[model samples]
Target chain A: MDMTFEIIGWLAGICTAVSFVPQSLKTFRTKNVAGLSALTYTVYNLGVLGWVVYGAYLKSYQMVVFNAVCFAFSFSVLAMILRYRRRSRL
Target chain B: MDMTFEIIGWLAGICTAVSFVPQSLKTFRTKNVAGLSALTYTVYNLGVLGWVVYGAYLKSYQMVVFNAVCFAFSFSVLAMILRYRRRSRL
Candidate 1:
């Protein structure tokens, strides 16, 4: 049971770590922030950065690695949103 | 220093918990999934659920609380994506 829970945690970590891929890929290709929220990604990236730092403080490699990957993907998406944001629709 | 990291982790958790709100609200209002990724939210929801269960096993209320809030917001977004996704845009 303990091992099962551990596996669940590990899998959960991986799921979140990689989940940003799809959004980043689609945004990268489409360059669309029409439906994306700048505030969401902005806060999310800062959270991930905090997590990375917290993980480092905790000496937890799993936390650091997972959040680092999320940061990379989410930050990329956020940057794209800024780059391609619709300034004015006429 | 330790307390600072703890505070960081707490803040990080709160940021993640609330970060989904803007996206969900925007998607709810605009009914746009053009910039949203179904797979990302789908996986993220699953991951958050897993974290809730993992927290239960670990007897960690913080994990459960934060992730449960995230699940609520993110699931709403995912539902919006499925509901509002355009089909056969011609």
Candidate 2:
């Protein structure tokens, strides 16, 4: 891959990875996941995991790191959603 | 790129692209975006747009197509959130 493409990929990864911050913060603060769909998040996390595997196969360190962070953020949000939902039901 | 890497990329892209469907469906069904963060969606859209640009640069048709679909889904969710927030305010 060219240097330009590599740089662009990093930029893209950073944006996507950081984008989850606000949502996670909101979920943590509000504890309101009424509009959040557990199914969608579960599927999204699977996709991120796929990226992690792909990154490992390609030996792209940046891809692996970014996707890993994204996966963590997504997983946290999912966990929070589940916790809040369970609490609501109880 | 190796065929394996390319195949993996395609699979990852498809997974991420299609993952948005359930969220979009739920949003439309409930018209409830209270748990969805407009900030996150907006930022996520930017990241997807970055992927679209990167794909164009790479001449990767699969990347372009999948990111395009993902972008549309994310944008629709953001728009719905904005609309709902406005209506709630009114």
Candidate 3:
């Protein structure tokens, strides 16, 4: 059971990380922010911050590591959106 | 610190759960899974399953509760995708 939990933890962490791939790819490929929502990503980054703090408090390396990666991914996505949004307005 | 962690945990859980909203809305409105990848979602579901087990092992209520909600949301989205894919094919 213990080993099972560890395996599950690893799978969960990896999946959660990998789940961002599609959007990342789309953003990278299209360089378009037309479909993605600014508000959503803003809240997402905030959420990531909260998660990182929470994970640190709990002393959970999995939570900290994964949320930090998510933060970086989301930040990049947000930057892309802002850049495209600005470019479109120009 | 404990209180702070609890607050952060709540925020993280809510954010993670809320993150699914845009995709759900898009899927609901467009009835289009063309942009969404089935493989991504399949892996997401598996990840959610793993998180549930890991959370249980860690005795973390936040993980179990939030992931369960996310699981339901993702399941609905997946079902919608399947239905739409079938409809589109015909």
Q: Best by DockQ, which number?
A: 1
Q: Candidate 3 - CAPRI tier?
A: medium
Q: In model 2, which runs have C-alpha deviations exceeding 4 angstroms?
A: A1-8, B1-8
- Measured on C-alpha atoms, candidate 3 has an lDDT of 0.76
TM-score of the candidate numbered 3? 0.79
Instruction: Kindly list the interface RMSD, in angstroms, of each predicted candidate in the order they appear.
Output: 0.7, 1.8, 2.6
In candidate 1, which residue pairs get closer than 3 Å at backbone N, Cα or C atoms, i.e. clash? none
lDDT of 3 by residue, A1-90 (tens): 788778878978888767666666767787756645566578777887888898889898888898888678767778888998999899
Which is the leading candidate under TM-score? 1
User: What's the iRMSD of model 2?
Assistant: 1.8
Question: Against the true structure, candidate 2 has what lDDT?
Answer: 0.87
DockQ of each: 0.87, 0.66, 0.51
Return the DockQ of model 3.
0.51
For B1-90, candidate 3 gives per-residue lDDT tens digits of 688789878987888767667767767886756544465567777888788888889998878888887787777777777889999899
- Writing each residue's lDDT as its tens digit, candidate 2 over A34-76 gives 8898887898888888899898988888889989999999889
Per-model lDDT? 0.91, 0.87, 0.76
TM-score for all models, in order of appearance: 0.95, 0.91, 0.79
lDDT of 1 at B49: 95
Off by over 4 Å in 1: A86-90, B86-90
**Which residue pairs collide, candidate 3?**
none
